[model samples]
Structure formats: structure tokens, C-alpha cells
Target chain A: MATALTRLPDERLAELLHGYRASSAGPRRRALLLALTIAFLVAVAAQVAEVDLPRLWEHAGAFFGYFDRITMLESGAGRVWADPAEWFWGWRKWGVLLLDTLLIAYVGTALGGLGGFLLAFCASANLVSNPWARGAARRFLEFCRTVPDIVFALIFVIAFGLGPVPGVLAIAIHSMGALGKLFSEVVENIDMKPVEGANAAGASWPAMVRFAVLPQVLANFISYALLRFEINVRQASVLGFVGAGGIGQDLIEAIRKFYYNDVAALLLLIIVTVMLIDLGTERLRHRLIGALESRA
Target chain B: MNRAVTLRDAAVAEMAGIAARHPQQFRAMPPARLRALALFLASTGLLVFGLWRLEFSPSRLVDGFGQLVHFLGLMIPPDPGTWSRTMLILRGLSETLAIALLGTLGAALLAFPLGFLAAWNTSVNRLVQFLSRRVLDSVRGIDALIWALIWVSVVGLGPFAGVLAILTSDIGTFGKLYSEAIEAADRKAVEGVTASGGGKLHGIRFGVLPAVLPVMAGHVLYMFESNTRSSTIIGIVGAGGIGLMLSEMIRTLEWGVVSFIVLLILVTVAVIDTISGRLRAALAGARAG
Candidate 1:
């Protein structure tokens, strides 16, 4: 049978292969079918949306012109290929703005990271050991996350008057919720042995937490904080809409004034800054985790 | 008695050593290093600059409380205006909900496979994982608002653009989240499937997906709640939602309309949040149970 099958031509062998194909069952195949149905619905939705592709084509030049102005392109390729100093000046302003944005995020994340760590410890089942206490902390985290950061910023702007303070506070609140949850999860995942050992040795709860759990999860906490800091940096750019201050204010101002060149410059700075931060965070996380694993 | 005293002294010394080793990482202070010193100075400088830039005066704050009171006085009664406009607002809200659902669904659909590929532990090859991870990074790195701005240009305005914005941004988010979940999954299950002669996809199907599905669902549902609010903002870009109306209200200084719209938005967000929370809890409970 094997020899006969081997003798078959490629196309004929493909035909013979049809019989061996697995019959689809279970939710996976159902999900595929459901996706196709959803795709059909989306097509209908697209029609209803009146996406205006023809109009876009008609207005393509104008749209492209807007982008050119925003990006400050003298020619199609010249914007990217321009002189270094000219590029440097353009890049410098953006770099400064980017730093301002990072400052906003860093302040916010630091405040939130501290708050979140405390809250997470309080919320942790092992640390708190009291269901009500844990529940309260958890609920607080939920509430913080439930409200959008922008809404929080808006409220803070109203309360504290508009500025980076509101922006920082908003991001901090968001970080607290996000990092609190992550920190709690990390706490839950810690090896029980050290905790048990500490407890058995008549160590106080605080001492156990400080010596055992903290040591175990400190790198994880830092990694999470770094990741959240990166996210807060992005969020800082977002909070400008509500009059919360940062480089986002410039982005909004550029849009308001139709200064497309400034917008492009600002956006380029943001992309580069965020990308660099992400790379740095990833490397730091790898180093920390690697060290921890080696220690283990 | 001497041995007992020695043991107590050793314990105290050991504890001091441990405290010195780990220091309270929760202090929220920069390290006492050059980098920390630089960062501290930078922060102080920024604080001064920001205070100056925003014209933040204590006197102004003291005076501003009166303005807050007056604003509060103006928003006294919650008004829904004409029935038709109210209906229009509700209709617009439903559109926003639809945008969130479809966008998140579409993003998760695409991201599911890509996320699996990106998961370092379970990927087919290093190249595939690296490429997929990079794609996820790029997707997530760009803010959703920026994605909306780009999509609005590409697809032209309306809910379609809004949906695309959410979809594109969420693809990045879901990819990162789902990949993390995949990485966090029990290796023993994968090992078990592999040991039983299962193929890679089979291992994923039998082992990985089952473990990560609940967590992925939780993330998706959370995104749904988030996207509802996001849908509002993307509408400000003329993607056809209540945000367009709200932005118009703000532009025209129609405080009455603005308040009404804001209240509506708040209600919608709060309601959706409750629903998503319940769904997430249910999903998590079922999975854990």
C-alpha cells in the first residue's frame, strides 16, 4: 500500500490525501464558522458606514498634502533625507518634548508604583489573610481601573486645575490599578516554601513578607513597574486632551493650528522615545529575571 | 543559656543583613547613585518648569474654588433636552458599543494566532517568534488615538474608521496580552501533549489554548469596556460617535449639551464596566472551578 501510494503522482497523491484529512468538530471549527459569519456582518457594516473610498481617492492629494505639511516634507523624500543640523533642531525640540512627556510619566509611575505596591501587599491573600481586608483593596483597584484615565484626568483637571499635576495624578491612579493587580498576582505565584519556613520559625507577618515574598518577587515587581512606566509615558501624551499638560499639549495645539509639520515632528519623537524605552525595559527585564533565575 | 543568647544575636544580625540586602523597595525614592541624583535634579527642574508653564499659583487655586462653585451651580439639574435628540444620543451610543464589539472581536481573532506565534515558549521557530513579537510591539507602541488618526485618513471618517482604530490598536494589545498568557500557561500540559506524540498545533490546541482561553477572554472583555470609552474619543476625530457631538458641544460652548453628553457618556461607561466585570468574573470563576 505504501509502495502504491509512493508511486502516485503529486497531484493524484494530493487527491488521495483528502481521505486522511481530519473531520472538524468542537468549538475551534465552530469559532472559524462564526468568524466567517462575523466577517459577512462586518462587510454589511462597512457598507452602512459609507467608508467613502472614492471620495478619499478624490481627496487623496489634499490628504497627502496635509501629511506633507505635518511632516514638513519639501519633497517626497527630502523630509527624511534633509541636513543633519536642520534635522537636529527639529529633532531637538521633539526630544525635549519627549523628555517632558517622560517626566510626566515617571512622576506618575513612581507615585503609583509605591501606592500600588502597598495596596497589592494589603490585597494579597497570603499577606492580608483577612478576606474583608483583601476584598476592600481589590475593590478599590477595580474602581480605579473601571474609570478611564482620561475621565480621571478630567476630574483631576477640574479639581486641581489643569496641568501636569492632573495628568500625573491620573496616570498614577491608572498605574496603581494596573500594577496593583499585577503585583497581587505575582504575590500569589511566589514559592510557598520560604513563606512557610518563615512562618514556622515564628517570624512576624511583616518580617515574613519583607524577607521572603519581597525578596522572591522584587525583580518581578520592578519589571512590572518598568512596563507600567512605559505605558504611563504613552498615557501622558493622551491626557493633553483634557488640558493636562505634556508634549500631548503640543500635539493637540498642532492639530488645532493645522501645523502638520509640528505634529509629524512630535509624533516622530514619541515613536522613537517609546521604542527606545520599550527596548530598554525589555533588556532590563531580561537582565533582572535572568539574574533571579541564576540565583534560584 | 550562652548558646541561646548567641542564637538570638545571630538572628538579629541575619535580619539586619537581610534588611541591608533588600531595603524597602516600596520607598518610592530614587537610588542614592549618580543616575538617581541626576533624575532627582531633573524631576525638580521639571516640577519648577511645569509649575511655571501652567501658571500654577496657590493664590489662583484659592480663587478658583469660587469658579468651581459657580460651575457646579450651572450644572444643577441634569437635563436630557428634547426626546428626539436624546434618542439620537442613544442611537449614537449603540453605534459606539457595536464599534467596540466588532473591533475587539476582529483584533482578538487576528491576534490569537499571532499571539501564539509570539509566545517565546510555544512558537514554531525563533524567527517566527521574533517577527511576531516585533509586530506586536509596533502595534501596541503606537497609541490608539494615533492609530485612529491614521485609519481616519486611510478609510475616511465614520464608525468604520473608529472600528479600524480600535481594531488596529487592540491587535497590538491583544497580541501582547495573549502571548503573555500563553507564556504563563502550564508547561506540564504542553509536555504531556508532546509526550503523547501530539504535533505543535495539537499541543497548542489541547494544552495551551485551554489554559489561556479564560485569561484571554478576561483581557478581551476588559478591552471591550475600555474600547467603549475609547470609541467615544475616536469619535472626536469624526469617526461618528457621541464624541463628535460632545466635541461640537464643547466647540460651540453649549455647556448644557456638553454636560448632558458627558453625563450620558459617564452612564454608558459605568454600565458597560459593570457588565464586563460580571462577565470577566464569571469566565474566570468557570475556568478556575
Candidate 2:
């Protein structure tokens, strides 16, 4: 078999199959064109919307105006930051605000993660088995996520009288919806053999879930929780707009006051924080999953 | 029967005894870990700062409720007065629809190829896939509102800014969705393409794209429907559309006008949702059939 006609001459093979296989280039080109058309439509729409890029360039100063009010970098008439000593202190203040934002995310994520884990079981179609239970849980999750975070923040702010309570509550609620759905999805796709075996052994529901279900998707749950944590941090940054508390308030103040430099600085801080969280989460996920797999 | 029950119980006890001989899970959590001091100082510190900064109090909330109810009262008997104003409302809502369409289409275009490159199984290298996926993540990590604010600042406020924001934000999302679809494509067809002396791109173009395009198109359509609601809000930031009118109405305490715009937005969203739902179902059916 290895030497069967030496697999024929390369030229012979090319000739044998020639014209039989259609060239994919036509479809490839068509796909590319489709993409280009999509882009073109978007550009035309952007034009119709009349964004006025040139005007944006002209009144760039207003951006600065909005910035200063949010950051409180300027006191009295005209811009300050002349005193180097005050400048250093302002940097410290910025750090504190950043930490405050992190704290809001931490609390929100931990509480939400815990709630999501339990709700997830009820939501999973495979686990629930009961059609009505699954439908009710799924609908509950939809209702939870449909209301935007800002809308939730506004409602919470009204209820709690502003501050971190509202921000935390809003993030927690949103997280429950988002995390619950993802968790249930993971649950649905997990191996059911162990669960079935446990059920056959006369184990109660709780015991079955504990012994059979969780071990399969625990890593996934952790991975999702970490991902949500990173998201919560970003969300925390914007909670201050509604006076829910966090560095977002400072950022908004800077924007409203037209402090462009401060805005730039705060943006830098946010970008760095996000990158760090992302990296840390990735590493933690790898470590946790690695250990889980090795143990199994 | 009584003897049979006794034998069953005796057998269970023997099985438990045998299982005890093969013990598992030896580790135990440390008691000191429970007693360890949990950090609350930072949380409290931030909470205090928040309280001070927002000037938030329970009494203020009570007071605000009255004002909220008063505003609600003012919104009663929404009068859709004058043909010109009615036309204006319709026009603003249409602009929003246009924004959603453009944004979804634009994102789909930019996302598909990049998504192909980002797919773990289809990609030429792990590095390219990883980098592209992260780029998509960052794009999706931030909310549409932030994008509107940034673009509004960059482009200087208008419907254009709103349009740009939705497109930019949706691109990242589309990339993530498209990549997942590509990853899930049947490997057999891809392998068949490869066996015919086709390169990676050839296989993807013929074998993968056809399989996933419908799903991707359905996703794009759904996004368009969702973005319509978002486009309304972006307009508040001077991006353009009904949001501008709504915000203006709110500011001027024209509750009637606000209610009219809100009703318009709800109706528009509901209609788009129905249409998109039908489109998605059709696409799925076509794929299955």
C-alpha cells in the first residue's frame, strides 16, 4: 500500500482532479465584499446622523470644562495645579478614589457570585428537570438583566438615598442576572452520568447535587466569577454619575468641570486598573482550573 | 419479608464498613482561618466618603419621592399636539432605528474576518487568536454609554457620535460572537476542504463561512434590535435621535412630551424585537433545513 504506484506522479494527480474542485476564491471574495458593504452602510449612517467631527475638534475646550468640574482640580476662577505640593496630594486623592472603586466591585462581586451559584442550579434545564421550574427561573433572570445597570442604580439611589449602597446593590442585581444565566448554561452542558448514578443510589437532591454536579462545573463557575469581578470594577467606575459613590463621581466631576488633563489622568488610571485586573483574573483562573483538573 | 429487610440492612452496613476502608478527602480547613480578621476598614472608609460626596440621606430620599410623584403627575394626559411635532417625534425615532441598523451592520463587517482569525481551531497561531480575542473583550467590557460619551467628546456631539458609539461598541461584541460560531463549526467539512489541497483560508472560506454566516447574520440582526433602545439613550449625550428630545423634555419639565417620547421608544423597541425574532427564527430554520 505504501508504494502503490508511488501515489502517482504529482503532475498526474493535479491533472486527475483538475476542474473537479471549485475554487473557493469566489466565495472568499464575496465574503470580503459583504464585510465592506457592512462597513460602508455604517459610514453612511454615521454621516446621516451628523456627528460633526470638525465641531468636536473646535470645542475641544468644553471637554476640558466638563473634566474640571468632576475632578475638582480647579478652585476659584481659572485653572490651578500651580503648587507642586498640592499636585502631589491630589495624586494621592486620586489613588484613594481608585481604591474605593475596587472595594465597591469586590463587595458586589462576592455577594453576587454567592447568590448566582445557588440560583444557577434552579435555572439549569438539565438539573431542574421540571419544565415549569426552569421556565420560571429563566424568566426571572431575563427580568433581572433587562433593566440596565444605570436604571437600576437610579432606582436604588432613590431607595437607599445615594452612596455606595445603591452602586453595590445595582451591580449585585445585574451580576445575579448575568452570572446566573452563564452558570446555568455551564450546568446544562455538564456530564449527567454522575448525577444519574447518584439519583439511582437513593441520594436526596441536595446530596446528589453536592456529590455529582458541582465537581464537574466548579472551575467554570470560578472562571465566570472572576470575569464578572473584572466587569464589576469597570461598572463601579461609572456608578458615581448617579451619585452612587466611587471614583466615577470624581471622574464625572472632572468631565463636568472641563478638566481635560485630569480626565486624561483618570483614564490612564482606569485603563491600568482594568489591565491589572484582567491579567490577575486570567492567572487565577489558570491556576484554579489547573489544580481542579490535576485533582480529578 | 421481615427477614429480607433485615438482610438488606445488614448488607448496607457491610458496604459502609467496606467504604470506610478506602477513605478520601483527607484535608481540612484551618480553624485559624475562621478567626482571622476580615478587612472592613477600607469598605467603611469608602462608604463614609460616598455618604459625604453624594450628600445622601434617608430624609432626602423621602423628599425626592414627592418630587418624583409630582413629576409623574405632570406627565399625565400626554397630548400629541400639532402635526409638525408629531412628525418630529417620528423622525427622531426613525433616526434611532437607522442608528441601530448602521451600528449592527458595521460591527458585523469588522467582526467576521477578525472573528475567524480569533477562533482557536481555525486560526493560524495561538498568539493572533489571543490578541484579537482580548481586543474584542476590551471593546465589550465598557458600556455603550461610555462609548457615546467618548465619541461625543471626540466627534463633538450629534447623531453621528451616537452612531459611531454603537458601531464601535458592537464591533467587539460581534467579534466575540462570530468567533464562537466559527469555533463550533463542524470540523469534518473543514477537514475535507484541507484534504483537497486547500489552505487554511480556503477551508475557512468554503467550509466554515457557509456554516456560520447565517448564525452570524442572525446575531447581527438581533443586535440591531437591541441597539435601537441604546441609541435612544446615547442621544441624550448629544449623539442624536429621540433621546435628545426626551432629555430636553425632562429638563424643561415638559412631562407630556417626555411621556410621548417614552411611549414612542417602547413601541419602536417592541416592533423591532418582533421583526428580529421572526428573522432569527427563519435563519435558524434555514440552517437546520
lDDT (C-alpha, whole model) for all candidates:
0.77, 0.75
Candidate 2, superposed: residue stretches over 4 Å from native: A1-48, A51-89, A114-137, A186-219, B1-92, B107-143, B169-232, B241-289
Q: How accurate is candidate 1 locally (lDDT)?
A: 0.77
lDDT of candidate model 2 versus the reference: 0.75
- Which lDDT tens digits does candidate 1 get at residues B1-52? 6999999989787986766777764345646545757966986676566555
DockQ of 1: 0.20
Q: Write one digit per residue (lDDT tens) for candidate 2, span A1-296.
A: 46443478888889767744456667678779977986787666656666455775676665555555434444543443454343344688889888878878877776677778888999998878898888888877765655556555655565466678778768878888889999999999989999999999999999999999987987798789889988888888877876778888877776667565566567657767887898899899999889778888
lDDT of 1 by residue, A63-130 (tens): 56666666654344467437445434556666666776787887778778888999999998877778
Worst 10 residues of 2 chain A by lDDT: A77-86
Maximum-lDDT candidate = 1
- RMSD over all Cα atoms, model 1: 7.8
